[model samples]
Target: MTAAKKAQGPVLTTRALNRATLERQLLLRRHTMKPADAVAHLLGLQAQNVKPPYYALAARLDGFEPEEFSALMASRELVRIVTMRSTIHTHTADDALALRGLVQPARTRELNMFRKGLAGVDLDQLVVRAKELVEERPRTLKEIREALLERWPDADPQALGIAARCSLPLVQVTPRGLWRQSGQVSLTTLTHWLGRDDGQEAVPDETVLRYLAAFGPASVKDFQTWAGLTRMREVFERLRPGLLTFRDEHGVELFDLPDAPRPDADTPAPARLLPEFDNLLLSHADRTRVVPPEYKGRTWLGNFAWSVFLVDGFLAGVWKLAEDKESSTITFETFGKLTKAQRTELDAEAVRLLEGPLGTGLPYDIRYEKVVGA
Candidate 1:
């Protein structure tokens, strides 16, 4: 049904919202598309750490091999950069450029958060010197901070580093993101890394459309939360006529692309493992559409976010992996009871995760532990 027509339709249940988002995120089924294509489809993967994108893609793509994704990074086809919400993410090169431009306003807001630390430093000169240093050679944040200290000895070193990151479109260099390859996080401008002479600015209208396509049937608050920008209601209002609109169970208006997928609520959703800080858990304001209320506030402990997995398409539990010379063990700590069938399905999925995506030759075991506070 057209988005306009759907406006007058029955209210969408939580399960219906869950299934539709899973379908768009490629979590409903593993797709055979190339990693780059998948990255584009989902906008990009939340890649604050090196391994999440690998794990994220492995869960969504059929027959995914880490080397295929690694090759994209090695060849500069895919890039790791700080974009949405000023968090590092892995994006296709084209998206790295376009999205960096689109989210510049958010990055500016991020800089404002550190303004007290940046006192007494010339922000304009800081961007110039930092850019020159990074473009000359990809420098670690430490290296950049120490160098900046030479010019602004009294300014907060950490803030200088953050200001440099916020002001410039810095991309985390390759070896840092390459699968199984470990390296320090280093930086260079997107222009320097991609060798593009064209303007990096993106049209805001196109950005809004892309957001809806990936995470939509969503509200203006959801978009603002995901993008870390404010006053986006005006943007959504301007695009309202051409877009589809629907009220969630709470009567929040959701806007979506007319042709985007919205699957039946009863569609079967498989159990799947997800890495820490996965976008599925972080991208929406009304996360009730994906995360159960009982599981809320449980995934994070202090500053570390635990990896989680889905059972019946909702956040079921936290997971941890321990590997030895002989075998790899995946431990699921559940918040509630699971049926025999659910346990069996999770076991089978865990086996596939170890042997298929992780490429571990060692024997594996899946074990369950009682939730700590349950």
Candidate 2:
């Protein structure tokens, strides 16, 4: 049977959806939530690299200091582990332990893509040896690879090392994930980081339910896509009676918690500077709500991708900051003609951003130039 389609209440124009997303993602304005709280509320932050999220948070959270997040890792309240879509994400320690088991299947599939390099290598035995090597003490990436070569001498040791790290519930140690610093990859057991004996247990449905609680009123596909799990349609069906469903105009189903913020389509949104690869941009399948169609080619740049200006919620244009020894100037180039007043407001926001948060310390000089024939 086709799912129920409630009458469209207010057609949230693309701009309206963009604003709502910015508000929810904390990009519309800097907020005061602690790093751990912020990570928990957003489910997790995209942490492909460590420093990016620190800067990303700094841009969004008021008075955000790097140590605020670094301390969480030190306290074992938060952990840097492989979770959520089998990508590197920084999540609460409790969530890390609970969700690791749930996403293992996805991890295994991803790990296999590099398996040709591990041909004739025994993976089951490798995990045992890999765990033994790290259990005694943390080891740097090179050290781990050298030790693994003892068991699989002919195998590509680097590939072997990466596979073992992902297969096992290993957490990348800090200084590795520290803010404003660069460090070598190091391996330590997740159990060691969290200081818990229950690391081996299978995560239960409550963990999946927690994802639903935050990003819900969503379909099983959305859940699996975000969490990087599979064979979970049954899970969504099981949870169906407890969720609220609505079909978008395209007939694709969307699910969310009944009480979650599906705010009015007309809610006012402000200009935002989003970090590259912000969760707000990467979290969805349908991006029409935030990125304009014509600007897609520019947003998905060929070589140089800069942080974007989300004006009135949707991405309006691209902005870049460049500096010589004496001064820094922000340049704005829009896809279409801007009214004189709009151009003025954009220039003001750019000045505030470079000086206010980035603290470039150089003088602020802003300029606007239209794309010829645009």
Candidate 3:
């Protein structure tokens, strides 16, 4: 049998996939890499909410100071922009530039979904005018939409706003994503914000390799889902000679970089706290690798994505923080029974999360709430 066939016979069990993913995600043990490096390695954190990236890096990096990430944003070395499913993410400046062009197709699809609402509006003019407004200075969505409406009063205002966002490479300005700081979501063109005169665009093959490096041994479907781009089978096929392949227990073909980390299934993974919409949960087509089926649906309550924590590298429960002037409290809601030892480890992790990355410097409490349905 060929080597590929040899590697395929043994099915990778769920726990095996779980352990391998945890190791790749830096959740098995914290690494000493710089925060920006960590962000790049993980292919950017799912950062619809500003604080998730800080919490995500803290969970994956050793001695992580929130300021390290904030500093990158402050220096424009890192940026927060809409990419990968057209959601806000904190990406290294390099990624913000390259990946944005690659995902333009996905953004165009996003605009198509609102085409009915955008009838009678000249989209070409909208893009030009939108660029003009924000390129001058960062403008709030409301401000941009109101201005667009003046020109296209018969068009759907909401659709006009979405059109601008979908058409432009808008970056959420600092203080918006800065730690412990709050500001309205403001936007400016990536070219203006980054001051890049040289033309650069997304390279799909490079993006595929990066995805594998961070969240891989994944199926093409997994990648398409994470990227919000479709018809990736051809891309994977083109790179097949340079990639390694394996099969999960369910017989799905999985792809990976030839030299990427794939730790032994028995590798130990510690407890970790993850913010709402953490990339780990959202980056896969089959989340069975990181989320047990029993606990899967619990992460979402209606439309809200709850903050969560991991025990033994698998999602154990959902978490929320309640804070007062004097103290902060973490409310952990578990889907099933956790061992006494797991609870202890989770508590310790929570404390570190609050005092360290959270930087609250206040006394805190961790409370457990039993899972209602599960």
Candidate 3 lDDT tens digits, 282-333: 9889998888887768788786898999988888889889878999999999
Q: lDDT of each prediction vs. the true structure?
A: 0.87, 0.69, 0.87
Model 2 weakest lDDT span, ten residues long: 1-10
Q: Name model 2 segments beyond 4 Å from true.
A: 1-20, 28-30, 198-217, 300-305, 319-353, 356-374
As a whole number from 0 to 100, the lDDT of residue 173 in candidate 1 is 87
Order by TM-score, highest first: 3, 1, 2
Clashing pairs in 3: none
What TM-score does prediction 3 earn?
0.96
lDDT of 1 at 139: 96
Q: How do the residues 93-130 of candidate 1 rate in per-residue lDDT, one tens digit apiece?
A: 98888888788888888889989988889999999999
